[model samples]
Target: MAYPIIFLLFLSLPFSSAKLNLDYYKATCPDFENIVKENVFIKQTAVSATAPGLLRLFFNDCITDGCDASILIASSAYNRHPERDANPNLSLSGDAFDIISKIKNNLELVCPGVVSCSDIVAQATRDLVKMVGGPYYKVRLGRKDSKVSDAKRVDVNLPTTKMTMDQIIEKFTAKKFTIREMVALNGAHTIGFTHCKEFSDRIYPKVDVTMHPKLAAGLRRVCQNYTVDTSMVAFNDMSSPNTFDNAYYKNILKGLGLMTSDYLLSVDPRTRPIVEEYAKDQQAFFVDFAKAMEKVSVLGVKTGNKGEVRNRCDQFNNNIPE
Candidate 1:
């Protein structure tokens, strides 16, 4: 799992170099990233869940159809089944969507229709990660918002908490991610919260032996009435719920990871060593995470005639009401 960061950088160059670059918006928006940063600071500071929410939003957007912000699209009367309407994405943070809209409206005030919502999702997510104690990574711009946002395309693309280690491996492998990259990407769970329904299976019907008794018991309390209180949720990282760090791996080591998938990563020999390395070395986790984000960010990106810069993120350029 000790893949060289230098080699990863080389592998990433192809995706980032052709149509995307660090300065893709330098001439067009001039202050694109700065605007994204400003909006993230304002909106994220007001909501404790904003940082992790936006990060998860990025994951949802990218993992399905690259980083084209398709997940941000609202289901219209004619298109009443956009990606956000998917069951897996039904729990996506509204604050995260609000932050992107905030950035979009603010940018339009100065840059007009120059910036793409897809790029905003990527940049704002990177800024938010740094805001909550994660590594600062560069995101290349120039991605155009996708014209597609099918909910049907989403369900199979998403990784759920109930997936076993083998299932998780298959999912990531289908996306071109290596086992080490898969483990590194899972580290993003460090800051996010999961709804009780997502993991109740792990704690109910007898707590799994791999889970610590105390952790299982506590989860029972939080999720006991989750069926009635759909909003009930728990943080993924027990050690530092809000901080983005290796505490997730540490929590897994102590049998405190909140999901079946998370617990499996600690015990699966193929992934456990990578998890152990991340737990012992925070920098390693950050470096690989940033790279994984980069790879995911650029996956299946749309360009040129394939995409467009949407004036309103919730609807496509042509779908905007006249």
Candidate 2:
């Protein structure tokens, strides 16, 4: 069938060579990852939710012009708009930026000028995942901080909760991610929360048939007064709000997926099988997720002489040069 053909094509897609390697900082900064992990653990203790926030930050940064830390750039006096200013990125946690800044400061103390802000983000994402009981995967470093960031690009490239299966697939395919990879990456939803405004459509007008009736009722209760307070929130995976396990996929199987795209992974014929596989096998999900994360993290990356190591994670290197 079409599913098998698609799976074959996914297997056949050649991995892009981003020139990133595991040994990138071995000679220059052997303690790079340790510094990042230590800071992430310290921040995680104060805000238990920092893990998902950092994970989301990594995904946002990578999806837009690769994982060059472009998302970390703040709009300045010269340029009034940056990637984080975009509507799609408004939900991104400011804490993510703060945590990365903390890690960057500590790294500069030891490896002054050797580490890049982009690499800090990538490494911190891995450390955050491990801290939250997720699989520990090696991440290739050596990414440079991007100098350019545009708010417009985000609306064009980022996937939203309301996106249909086809739209989501097309977005991922543009980044060279396969359908299976897209599904696995969606599993990251296991640990995050969604704004009520983002999913109120499924609850109002009419209950989406895909959502479990009881789950839908609970959502309605949580969001009944959301209009008065747009900041109302709900966990993405009700089964396990903090764990990075296969519970997200299993929740979808039970019609408990919180987002429209989440529900579609099961209802759509092309993605359902992959979702079922992940629900049954957490290891399979983790393996595929790690591979996908590695691949996606390097999309459109700038290496060599392309970008610079930012002194401050929130500003361009040229804007605040050392």
Q: Report every candidate's CA lDDT.
A: 0.87, 0.85
Q: Score every model by TM-score.
A: 0.93, 0.91
Candidate 1 structure quality by residue, lDDT tens digits, 23-86: 8887888988788888888887789799888888898888896788899989897678898999
Candidate 1: residue 209 Cα off by (Å): 2.3
For model 1, the local distance difference test gives 0.87
| Candidate 2 ranges with C-alpha deviation above 4 Å | 1-18, 320-322
> What lDDT tens digits, residue by residue, belong to model 2 across residues 1-322?
3578867755653333346778888988888877887889889888877889989988988898778888988888855788889998888887898999898888888889989998888888988888887888878777788878888889788988888889999999998789999999998988978888898999997998888999899999999999999778899888688888999999988999888888889889999999999999999999999888877777777877778888888888677322
Q: Residue 212 in candidate 2 has what lDDT?
A: 93
Q: State the weakest 10-residue window (summed lDDT) of model 2.
A: 9-18
